[model samples]
Target: MANSLHDTYLTGLKNAHALEAQAIQLLSRQLERIENYPDHAMMIRTHLAESEAQQKRLEAILERHGTSHSMLKDFMTSLSGNLAALAHAPMQDEILKNTFANYAFEHFEIAAYRSLIALAEEAGDSQAIPLLRESLAEEEKTAEMIGAVIEKTTLEYARREAAGQTAGI
Candidate 1:
């Protein structure tokens, strides 16, 4: 039973790691095409860097537990994120779509980290708590930031539409 609980905790950490990698890919794709929304692009670029750091933290945690990330899962998730971003790239509502998607993704990450923290506590992995909490804070901050961006983007889009200008680049 102890071994099974530990295994579950490690699996959760691995999934979080893969999700962060997927976030990086998604942000990268959106950043490339967010020329019209400089603020939004900047926020995503910053979060991209944070996501990379969070991935490293997860790697360290997994290594401490004598496990490693699932490379296959990471690759598949990254590919899926890129494809999803690409699908919205050429659309007139790309900004709106991407902003909404980012907001949703951040919440997903927050939930994953929250679950990992709970799992770590159950497994008596005290050392993992601080790292998981730090990542959780970052995810929460990004989610809040994205929420603001969504509001700003919506207003800006409305204004542009009213002026007969394209709302997306």
Candidate 2:
């Protein structure tokens, strides 16, 4: 049972690492394409830094466990992240779509971190709990930030569209 818990904790760490990588890639792509929404771009930039820190924290924990994150997992997840950003690029409602996606992704990260924290506790890794909690807090904060702007962003997009201006960021 101890070995199984440890293995599961390691797997959770690896997955969280990959998820952070994907988030960084996604934010970078979106940041590049954003032209109209300075506030949204700024939000993404902030979360990007947080994601980088989260990834590093995960790495430190993994290294302490005598393992490293899976390069293949990171690469594949990053590819998907890039593809997801690209998918919204051509839409007239690109900004709206990206906003929705970002909000959903933040919640997903929050859930992942919560599960990782539980696993760390079960595995008797007290050291990892704080790091996981920090990541979890960041995710929760980001989700709240996104939630706060959803209505304003959607309305802004609508206004721009009604004015026949370029609305997709």
**lDDT (0-100) at residue 86 of candidate 2?**
98
Off by over 4 Å in 1: none
lDDT of 2 by residue, 1-169 (tens): 8888889899999999999999999999999999999999999999999999999999999999999999999999999999999999999999999999999999999999999999998888999999999989999999999999999999999999999999988
Lowest lDDT 10-residue stretch of candidate 2: 1-10
Expressed as tens digits, the lDDT of each residue in 4-93 for candidate 1 is: 998899889999998988999999998888777788878988999999999999999999988899999899999998998999978888
Each prediction's Cα lDDT score?
A: 0.90, 0.95
TM-score of each: 0.96, 0.99
Name model 2 segments beyond 4 Å from true.
none
- Clash pairs, model 2 backbone: none
Tell me the lDDT of model 2 at 106. Answer: 96
Position 94, candidate 2: lDDT: 97
